[model samples]
Target chain A: MTSQTKAEQTGAAGWTRRRFIITLGAASAAAAGLTALPGGAAWSAEDAKTVEEEIKRLMGGKELADGAKIISMDLPQIAENGNTVPLEVSVESPMTEADHVTTVHIVADGNPRPGVASFHFSPLSGRAQASTRMRLAKTQNVIAIAEMSDGKAYMTKAEVKVTIGGCGG
Target chain B: MAKPKPRIRAPKKASKGEVIEIKTLISHPMESGQRKDRKTGEIIPRKIINAFTCTYNGQEVFKADFHPAISANPYMSFFVKVKESGEFEFTWVDDDGTTYSKKSKLTVN
Candidate 1:
């Protein structure tokens, strides 16, 4: 109205620009939210304890005795890859019906789920041993618990240091 | 759909009452459902081998339950006590309801 053509033209275009900026901001915010979810939840120390507690509860809340010699866990001291780590567990026992290893529970305390896998054995198995590859979310303890037919439980723990790719921050 | 190929390495011969080892590996990507597509930025649905079982002479010898944290090309090894000549069957169940299986024969002398 006062011969201010340039200012008036800019004011009209500024509204559209503001809306565009707002839309872009919202889109980025949504992407951020998605990234914050699911896999982003790192395995924290508290989570490790929770995993141990859950395993204990599954074991009837009874503490597992340290199996210094009976149980052997074969895993690398330093895992170069966090995604694929080979593990082996062997229990020295006579595969007899009277005295045999019943089950072995594998737990990676640092993974999202503590209990990785469980191996069951019968006298027909002749040996209590298993090998498998698993993903480790982070640096944590890998535990193996072997339950015998005589109602005795033994456990061993090994720490694996995960060295490569994790949540790409 | 192209089926997954399962491979097994087990000795064909063993002494009677001998403990033998069996190894198995399957071809699978094992998408953890926790990943996102790099280009589309979309979450990839989780798919994995959820379970594995081995039976000898129609009797269960070994079994395992797997989570998403298992490796891509899932590999497992277990021991078995061979009693006589029998067939060993290995089975793997995927998350998508696909079952991949293979068989091997063992002759215990």
Candidate 2:
């Protein structure tokens, strides 16, 4: 009985060691492919841009005014699914040639990438309103920034609790 | 993969200078390049619709730039003011330099 138990224990240990080696080999192979593949460079480059960097790239150092009165966002307080979270943004603006919302940018703080979408509007867009669905990696804040034709920007943010992460899938 | 299909919804008739809502959806995987293949454990390269535009009678009305964070099968809704009966052209540009477009006519009364 003692011999049999020892043999079983050794078999289990050997199985674990084999799994560890296989995992290490796979990880190294993936790392090598990430650098050696043709499109891999671009993929890593895109992954390097953080949320703050992306936001700066969009805003270009412009002052963001408080949008509490002008901008309104409709988003779920708790998203059951992070893969598809509904988002709606609207700005109080009279769609006119002289004064209108030129662009509305959506950015998620906890997404793999910050930028969600940027909507460009014109006077023909009678209302400064838009709705779309986005993916959230985790529980994070969703920010909406509206750039007006008059060269001013309005910004607002809301937090959304996510039950499951969307990026891993 | 099947060809990405474009779908749009807009009112067929509207009063002059009336505001109307338009919704558009396109079928695309929007592969974020972050997910790994279950069997191969290999990362899937990203391929998504990057830009969408709506033009009324040749004048650009609404445009959007999309990133990977956009869900698969992108859907967008916006507003437009109709001044006259004309065709609204909706275009979706993919990351692979392919453009898919659809047109819808609106009659202004």
lDDT, candidate 2, A1-169, per-residue tens: 5446565556765644222233543464445322122223156354325667776888877899999789999999999988899999999999899999999999988765778999999999999999999998778999999999999998999999988666644
Model 1: residues with Cα > 4 Å off, grouped in runs? A1-49, A165-169
Best by DockQ: 2
Which candidate number has the best lDDT?
A: 2
Q: Rate the local accuracy (lDDT) of all candidates.
A: 0.78, 0.85
| Poorest stretch of ten by lDDT in candidate 2 chain B | B34-43
lDDT of 1 at B53: 92
- Model 2 alpha-carbon drift over 4 Å, by segment: A1-41, A44-48
Residue A54 shift from truth in candidate 2, angstroms: 1.2
Cα deviation of A76, candidate 1, in Å: 0.7
TM-score, every prediction? 0.79, 0.84
DockQ of 1: 0.36
Going through the candidates in order, their DockQ values are: 0.36, 0.42
